[model samples]
Target: MSAMYGHRAKRFPKLPEHRRDQQIPDAFRTTMAGEYFMLGQSASRHILVLATSSNIRLMATRRTWALDGTFKIVPQWYQQLFTIHAFAAGKLLPLVYCLCTDKDIGTYGFKSQALIIRAAALEVDLNPDTNICDFETALIPAIQGYFPNARAVHRIAGELGLKTRYRQHEETRRKIRMLLATAFLPVPHVNTGVSLLEAGTTGTLAALFQYFRQEWMTDERLPLWNVHNIRTNNHLEGWHNRLNRKAGKSHNGLYELLQLLIAEQGVMDTLIQQVLSGNAAVGDLRRVNKVYAQKQRQVARYTGEYTNVRRTLKQFLEALIRVRAAMYGHRAKRFPRLSEHRHDLVLADQFKTTKSGEDFLLCQSNCRHILVFATGTNIRLLAACRTWGMDGTFKIVPQWYQQLFTIHAFVAGKLVPAVYCLCTGKDIGTYGYIFQALIDKAAVLEVDLNPDTIICDFETALIPAIRGYFPNTRVQGCYFHFCQAVHRKVGELGLKTRYRQHEETRRKIRMLLATAFLPVPHVNTGVSLLEAGTTGTLAALFQYFRQEWMTDERLPLWNVHSVNIRTNNHLEGWHNRLNRKAGKCHNGFYEQFHILIAEQGVMDTLIQQVLSGNVTVGDLRRVNRVYAQKQRRVAQYTGEYTNGRRTLEQFLAALMYLTPEPI
Candidate 1:
């Protein structure tokens, strides 16, 4: 039966040998319902477009259109299989399919012209309000040339190639995301947003901005890519994926591909008929994801406010942070078995010691399970290091624990994880107990562990606990966390909108954060300068800052001027690495324990290599060029202030100028 079926399938006529010899057969020139399926071909016979009459008529009614080309599913003779989709009744329908031998401007121009002539013959107007596509130099101009009144909106397809670079550099990722957010800015403020982004970039980012300026900043193309109200071309790209799946393979013969397209059209026709008859609902084929819906709401709100002159470009950019936060802030659901696995005896024994049989489990209780994976070498390094970095990650913790807390020591010019603790809660009692465990273990090992400074985030309970356990140690807050706190306070005080629209307001708010860079003695003077002439939200902001950060004891914790390493970003990076290794949020207890044990072994080997001078660990934290430049400017300002060349107010103003807007 299989052999006979194969023989029957091969009985069809041979396909064309080349583009020049290609000809549509009479049987394939019309739809199954007898409407013209081969709508038109280019004069050079190099481009052929297929669309039934109903497809053209439906496309003419749509105000928005999307165009894209895919090469993977194209036959070997053609350059690509280009598609034009129409958004009708909330469904993105592929209305026209074109096969082209070239991807040049002439080829696209011919395709556009053919569509226009075909639509004219059917006495239907084919004018779209917006056209979405990738940043194809040839296709963009072709669309603009034929449809001068239509707005061209470019998709984010151009930036997909930079995904790896984005993952490696957080600052670069933030800047690139902000660039995409420029599309949501008001038409008049789009250039201003781009300019602000360009001013803060350097190195590779400078080259990226240069490309953006040259290709997308021109008068003719500026409006083409700014699509604040329109949807992206993701749905159109999805349709192409479906087509590839239906065809089963790439480079199908001419007849085979046509048959697939015809079948797709038949399905679409049935859907259209059902929708028109009220038997089916007419909307997006797939439900919008929650994150995407929230982002759309935010954009809509921001744009609505812009029209009323109540919102500014800076606010829109700030709102992008909220949008991004929404994407990553979702809490993972807990699994009952995963949480209970912490009490399993076999798993407990498995995780109680290092692979070499050293004591890795420091404490295991009903309320908490504190696992210290550091070997004795790590403990010695910890005792020798004066400045320790501490942080915690909640995403990858087992369901039974609240956070996977870590303590890192600066070893051989690199921050190395010295301890890992899985805590059941974030209260002061839990933190004090964990610190006590470390102290008692150090006593047993005869390693005196004393640190001059400990850098951590502003976790209220953890800070006091650290100070309580080590009376002489100074707990310095991360500078990044300090800025984040001030930004959050700005939102709390209802000053976010003002900060976004008013430059003076924004500068004053930034000056509050810049106080971190000032010497301890001069910080009060800087805050006094910012406090002058303040009323309303600004007054409240400075008041909150003074109470929370400028007290006699609290002042020293956040003042990072004399601190060489001002942020715990390295510790945060390590936690991220651990999260990736765990592979999923809220992993099984034994699985997380296994991952940590393996990491401890790796750390032991790394420590030995470092001590023997066989390996050197470079800075794990990525140095952001813009931030480094800002630091240099701060240093210059501080020196001038110390030399009496600038007044306190002058120094604060200069530092404020160097402060970056919260992303």
Candidate 2:
């Protein structure tokens, strides 16, 4: 008996053994009324769309559409059963069903194209004013690509897990409802309403507002979700529930599901006929009437027809605040003034430790907050590295500090920040104190912090302080800063216009800066070549360069020949990243400290990954195409000079040609 039942089941229409098969039996390719149902299938058989002629005609007349996908009711060969529904005789009815092999943008694109092509063949316009769907990131762009004129409304509030939160807390429920009310606002006032609500929120509610801003308030999605009369795709969900109940089981056989869909189409045809002939009622009007009445009341309130005058966005927000106060009583202040003065504030215990609970705060005193943020492993890496980069950023420093000074070490080919100091002064005394603190901390950790080369800018006070602290260390000035100094001198001598318009003047000035790239012995000769026939602003520029940069004590500081890493650009880029993370200039002391702590946490993870051989750090900096080409030319010229093919004068001219504008 079991064998006979198996044979009978096999005789029934079955799905293809492989999903790659695109052929469909003729008997199952049409609806019960003999209307073609299998509209189209993709060439790869990854997507198949089905719709009858009458349903397509009905879909063409509707102005709104709701799309959704169901998984449980699909056959084993398919991933999901996707559906598109439209209003027919005042009821939402599924007009199209698609069997997709995958849930990606490409599959949806195929489905959209099939419908468009079929509609064009039947000469039925498929333009919709509004399309409703869930927040599937892949589906939104696919729908927009095929119907650019349609406004795609995403059901955000339903899917964000807000319903459970709303029912739990009264005050939170009121705030969440107010957030939903933003949908009813005029498109121009939506952002205003959100900002007003955001200002009044704090703690977890503030985080919720941030998420909303990031996900829904973007320019492309803002207009898509902000409709005056917002509608949801809840009706489509109900239709899926009905289809599941009719099927009686999950993962129904392909033939059985097709039969059920044909019967559904037949029922829809009869209902459509009944409503057209005036023999049956269209739909449940009570629920729709209630919705419309609520929308009208909201519109009347906004226009002041129900009261006195049109209300502003502020007035609407104030009304919500007043209602909340009436129901829940007055709330406390969101952000109270800090009790301690900005200069008196101290780091909390939590901020004193690294994310791994290691001691991170090396010293905190009245003069400076010297933070040596290296773990034991990081200290070892620092001791082993031969080069270091040091710089400070004043813009991101706390108001109580003069600058955020950072020390970076080259580790495994990547320049990683090793120490941070918040100093109250940019003087020799403050810098000396910072270095002393670092030395003391290194002594305690049993690691010596000595580097062979230190790269920095030509800060008048910083250079002298660095030399005094690390007398044996080699100090190399940034090559980019050298060019900037020469350009500034040119401007000071009132040669800005001549430098830009006169090619000879510009080349002479550039050659003066390009001497930094020459071999140490030849740099003076290169400068002397540029010194001949100099007068007026050009002579003054040369004198300034000699007095400031070429003195017996200053020559080696700026000359970068044979130096592997010339500029502190990697450190500068790190500072830029910190500025972006700080989000504003001169944040509060604790706020900036928190940002630093987060940065240390990231460094900790990276250190572990590096030690474990999971990550390989690349070049310290990335050079653009133009600068790379210039470097190639410089290399070629240097090679010629090394082989005695080119004279010193030719090398200087080639280097000058490659000099870029001050960066």
Candidate 3:
């Protein structure tokens, strides 16, 4: 009879017969004190704020707030168990419990019940200085609408975790990881780096670009991930995790959930006392404060490497972090996994478009090799040329390898980079791999790519491979590289800067080294002159030059009188342009890939322009216009009488007047 009497009598039906929003009667609205215990609510929505006491409301009014949710403690009918934690005295105290009907913008009672007005009644500021929350799509709109003036600090860890598992391929997957790694970087730098990373992504990987822009790259979301601030809602997350364990795994009823909150109120009161006494606090609050102090000092002491033309952003960051770590006698932390960085090498088939949407990545043939061309026509022009120029740049290659080498050839009289190769090392085997790939590619296209002459620096490892494969081809050395090598020997011999000042000795030493560029008969004559020359520094430099360059009649290999060009200036120019396009020496793989694709477009444009008769002799000649003009004039004088007809005075005064004015 007593148990039956405790149940409510249902003689009349309530407002909605099937309404899920069970009403809380006036009997449960207040505590022992006459002051209002539950926060104000309306019948239009199911809003019952638990533990909204004067003391808790007062503490919440003057402090920051973190709103979080847990599913484990929620009733079977409810969507989630929402908690609003007040950050006071460096601890997050659970001040309110909001049993939400559903996880949606409409389900929240902020608008329907006038949540801000009710909070104002308890002296609680609805809009605090900062409000930290998870990156929940539903929560974001509600918070933005309610707290327009408050700074929204969305936790970025959740987004970063989602991004780590974003793409399928390793290349794109790596880039997605880098997005989070770059969060600590300065804003402008992040903007630029993000754009570059975006350009490198395609196919399945490209989806992350939109994801980043939507979830993390928004203006409101950008500043939250700065290195100095709290980028994750660890405090709220930790509380939810503890609450979940406390409630156990099974779903509870509405009455049980309220009872759970009643128990939480006791714990909250205990935590409030601890916070006031400056005892134990949230782990995030303690650790972030402790680490930030040391981080600021370390960051200040270790002057970081600023990003520059020579150093890539990633390289600079790595060095900066390493320097900081070294100051503390620790290993540097590696941030951002190099993502789409290896796209060109690892996932070679994906990057297939250009800025103008052309077939930029010409071949996805082999993983061991990258045979890049500006266009299909570059192959044809390369095949037509009898001589090929080759050079490698160590600084401009991807960090994974030794050098970015290119094979150049004169196409329509303008020397252009024909084949770009990413070499693993500057060895005979590497060069053999490159040449064999080219030969195989040519066979597939039914085009003859065998060159009559191959010009390059004295890379011994490469020289043998070229000769062994293209046995009949003439191998020539660059005069500029040869001269640079001779100069290097002079430095090693300790001649000092004064070596060039001593004109007589300098000319004599040069004449001896110049023997390599002379005829077979004259080679011995020059060496003999050197042996008969004076016996000081000149003798030492000349003897070394002779033993190295003059031995075994090697003079014939460097004698440019037989080849069309002497210097590897075209090869050097190609490398310089490529380095600039790539933006750094040790560029990321994706960066190098983008550069290679762009280089293809540049070559194709030049080739098309030259073949169309748009490029004149003046354009082909990088020297002064007067030189090209003089060459053209000389061509017109093919039928001129004996050379004696043009006297020295006529050549000097008449030609000097024809020097074109500088534009």
Candidate 4:
């Protein structure tokens, strides 16, 4: 606080109560404008005046009067010590000094008389252009009555010093603060901000609403605080503060004040020299600048839901910090303890229970930065399924995490999402950690977590990790993913335009793309694009096929005819829906937890519909009847029951046994 005030008062006026005012009438007798004290003559009060000199008053080129009143340094007989300063050369210098005995409306009427007498004594007209003050109700009317042409401008127009007598709850108080801050904004935005506050408020806030409307947003107060280029009253406040320290507090005696006035003559000489030498004293705005910068930073940090609430909370907490620091021995400057992200507050709690009253967050590893969310029911469904489908989406994933990965399985022939995890890496090791954790947790529920077949996209990292982690499960790469990989290669080799120009070329290229459906033994031969054409895309497609697809042992996984499902479309559909629900943009770390809990709600609903006995996949099963029959016949013809390879004659005979008449 001391540093914030800049220059301090070094000189003190050695004065006591009655002597300060009693000797004032005699003290100014030899000055440029003689002193006058009239008691009970002006009204029902005493008036003492030591007005500015005629020459100084005549120097008022700009007719702006800055008036203020203080009471602590006045004599016991006086009620208030008033000073009127005139603005000249961009500075406010004292023009008139008066001490009044009462605070009545009639007493203030006498202030007008004193100013009129001073103006007439200086041979200058009393009409002024503008009057600047702290907007004291009594003094304003008196200043206006005295100088009717002077436009009153109140410099105390900001929300910093607002005092409310009404009691309010915490949330209500915050709303009030925000509404009041609009006073410092541009005129157009002030009304809009107030209206937003009013729309969101009710009950006791209406009282606050009325208070703001009457006091802050009033027609007279608007221009003073608006971007109307009005100057602040810091200059007047600084002068009053310096005056208090020099007078040394309490009531002053006449003889002590006479000596003080004699000292003030020397003080004015030094001040006048400093001002004329282009070295006028300015108040310290460092503290004010820091606070305003902090406010702008907070505005940049929050948006939509947290913007207003975060501002209110940060201010309240900062005040609490100062109060606590002052009470204890801690430093007052060390305000607001920093912590993790704000949304972490709720996410840490969500680890206990979800919105649907279920244990939501199963496990979180801070070191690995992996979060795994799965309800017990979803785990059970995953354990019961013989086959699983997996997919990952980068779009809807939280900003804290890289991607959203989920495992889904067919339940009653309708695919249902079971487990979701947010892992730190797309590497094989990260996927290994995630799967190992899932396997351990599922074991606790007395369920076998391994699936017979795991269907997924052809992410190179994913395939190897699934094979390494779950050795027994057969990993089947999705047929659509396989085609997508080849499609990308076609574009890379610049064959897409040629493929599109000729429909026959397009058809042959797609057939080669669909070679993932052929059995591994014939997969290469089935994609022979040269048989269809010898030019353009056909020749390039075969070269890419032999170099990229044929060299991998995972070729068998892309054999769509051997898998229970040819594509992981269910998982992709789920990703699309989640991306839409979670919105287009990314989310925060804890925001993902909230979204996962929402996905938990989705699983909860899917489970309910599955058990409700109303929903069924009967039609879907019937549609796949012929495909199922074909799968069984192919299994027999392939001779999976015996280790020895079957002869072509024996395999055809076995295939004929399962191939009954079509009727």
Please identify which of the two predictions, 1 or 4, would achieve the higher TM-score against the true structure. Answer: 1
lDDT by residue for model 2 (1-663), tens = 122134436656644535566477887788777888888877585777888877777778778999999987787568899999986545787889998878788898888888888888889989999899887879999989998898888765544445445556777776766776677566777887788778878767888899888987888887777756555787888788778767866677777777778788777776555533556555432145554445455554663631354566656654544443444322223222332344454657877888788777877764354444445656665676789899999987865568889988876547788788887777877778877877776788798877898999988888888888788889999987777778777888899878766888887887777788788888888899989999987898888888888887789998977676778988987887787677666776667767887888888877666556676544223544554555566677788887899887777777775554632
- Per residue, candidate 1 scores C-alpha lDDT tens digits across 1-663 of 122233435744565434566677887787677777897776465788998877877778779999998776776457889999987666788889998888888988888888888889889988998899988879888988999888888765465236556766777787788887887766788888889888967767788888888977788777777776774798887788667656655577667777777788877886655543556554435565777778778878877876787877677777776686776555322212232245552344657788878778776555455444556667777787898999889987865678888999876547888888888788898888878878887888898888999999988899999989988898898987788788889988898778866889988887787788788998898888788999988899999998888888788888878566888977887776676566556876666877888988878777666556676445334555555565576677778988999887777667665454443
Model 3 bad stretches (over 4 Å): 1-345, 348-350, 353-375, 609-663
How many steric clashes between backbone atoms does each model show?
A: 1, 0, 5, 8
In the range 569-613, model 4's lDDT, one tens digit per residue, is: 767767766765664357655555667777677668776565454
TM-score of each: 0.50, 0.49, 0.44, 0.44
Superposition-based RMSD of candidate 1 using all C-alpha atoms, in angstroms: 25.0
Local distance difference test scores for all models: 0.76, 0.74, 0.60, 0.60
Candidate 3, position 67, lDDT: 80
Compared with the true structure, the alpha-carbon lDDT of candidate 3 equals 0.60
Off by over 4 Å in 1: 1-347, 355-357, 367-369, 612-632, 657-660
Model 2: lDDT of residue 425: 76
Error of 3 at 118 (Å): 67
Write down the worst ten-residue block by lDDT for model 3: 654-663
